[model samples]
Target: MTQRSITVLPGDGIGPSIVAAAIKILDAAGCQFQYDYADAGLSALEKYGELLPQTTLDLIAKNKVALKGPLTTPIGGGFTSINVTLRKHFNLYANLRPVVSFAGTQSRFENIDIITIRENTEGMYSGAGQTRALDNSSAEAMSIITHEGAERISEFAYQLAVKEGRKKVTIVHKANILKSTSGLFLEVAREVALRYPQIETNEMIVDAVCMNLVMYPERFDIIVTTNLFGDIISDLCAGLIGGLGMAPGANIGKEVAIFEAVHGSAPDIAGQNIANPCSVILAAIQLLEHLNMQDQAELIRAAIKKTLAQGKTITQDLSGSASTTEFTDAIIANL
Candidate 1:
């Protein structure tokens, strides 16, 4: 992990603003990296007439690591989700989203630290859906759940828990209805759970998990589920600690991994200087950890915590009056 080379995609809207802030913070902390710039979202569409260009993917493949900002996916389906396409292209079958209660943040609960590990390459998001009936009638989507996919994600969840000192692993599934797909995922998950007997394990129906997630979000430690379920639950969990404004996600493959903020690109507030930069800064922390730069990662995390706890300079979304630059400066000053 010496002077890692990483692909950087400063996407559309507030993406560039926050990404620049994070890069400055990282540089100040002496994190060395050769950044290969690329494009993938609406910016790519406007610049290259394509949403996801080959050159962008090539850069990421060459570097095998990326720090991506939020991208705007057009409505009415101009392109498949750039995020999904990148995951499928790289076989990034594990989506890791850690939702923890941050100090001085707007949260309904406390002592909330949870990681949502989603099987990224399979389940309903496998992109295996088809539309039949020429009369505009029927459509079908396939949910693939193989033994390998389920076992790998489950094991990844357990291993992460062990490394991160988590105590419980919750397997959320929809096996009550999706007997084949969800059932296979759960069955394989159980097998994987057996390997880590020291870690407590539990199974909950997807619907039930959602209800409990609201009532007692602090009870969950590590939540591992299939693609669609994981996608939904990850956001739900994010809501407990405030919102996506404080959330960061990682898409991990065997050889490559990408870290990004789970929040959306706010088109209305693109260049307003009011957009929050905490999420992107937090995502950069994850990228630092990916490169085994744990000291640098911890430094940024501590700075964020200190800045938030001080409550001196904060963003609008966090119930403060500070602009994005002011908030970012506060974080750097804390460091």
Candidate 2:
């Protein structure tokens, strides 16, 4: 088979190390692919005077697939988040995050399986607008909503539920408060849900959804929500299965898909060899599945599960003493 190429953005801080570990595991799984490196995050700013360089965008355009690591965004002000920028630029409107319980992990939940499908490029993150009073006393940020955006995301969620054989899709929203904005979303989502009659659909206010998530998580199989709600709830779901250290994310569009670890760049731990690479490794598995490489994807998945269950060699976050490299090596050995 021909070797494929994928854009690799190591991102910032411990991003590089974890990304390398993910690549090594992929290699050990007998999956061959050429990695085309690109720069982003603060590191890219230092090199190219920008967080996202044209070259990096071009690389993704050329390869049509990318595997990214945790990228830190400026806290107060500076450049926009590269992750957000890339998603909007690529029109990647669906964000897929699956949170599942694994043995030997720190999560309290057991046998939990949920897929959070977030609207990737709209709502509060729609780049709508921001305005301040002339005296700087008051300010406002915009949350834009469109029928097209809501319809597509809802369709994607229902279709995904059918494809995965999921039983239900819970639509979380704040329609009672942000009536116009979230109302439009819920309205369109219900319309889309009508098409998938076999898949049960439920709706709830965002605040109430949060409460039930912790108390009755087993009631949910799939969650489809707007950008902001999805962002917050995805992390909450992550906490149910495990921390962000074990979560992986994917931004998908009609043209391309980019997979990433949902955690942040641990600048404090950069180069310390103590970061957990499982998140990125799982993202790599998603990448393989995207490419229709099911056999290789299953191999990597089994290897990761076996490695984690053994629990002898794991990163500190998992209550083990192994360094990042050692943890990766254990996964490779399982492979």
Best candidate, lDDT: 2
- Positional deviation of 132 in candidate 2, in angstroms? 4.7
Global lDDT scores for all candidate models: 0.88, 0.90
What TM-score goes with each of the models? 0.96, 0.97
In candidate 2, position 165 carries an lDDT of 90
Root-mean-square deviation (CA) per prediction: 1.7, 1.3
In candidate 1, stretches whose alpha carbon ends up further than 4 angstroms from where it belongs are: 128-134
Q: In model 2, where is the ten-residue run with the lowest total lDDT?
A: 127-136
lDDT tens digits, residue span 151-251, model 1: 99999999998998889999999898999989999999999999999999999999999999999887799999999999899899888887777888999
Model 2: clashing residue pairs?
none
Instruction: Give the alpha carbon lDDT tens digit for every residue of 30-70 in model 2.
Output: 88899999999888889988889999999999999999988
Query: Which consecutive 10 residues in model 1 have the weakest lDDT in total?
Result: 127-136
How far out, in Å, is residue 123 in model 1? 1.3
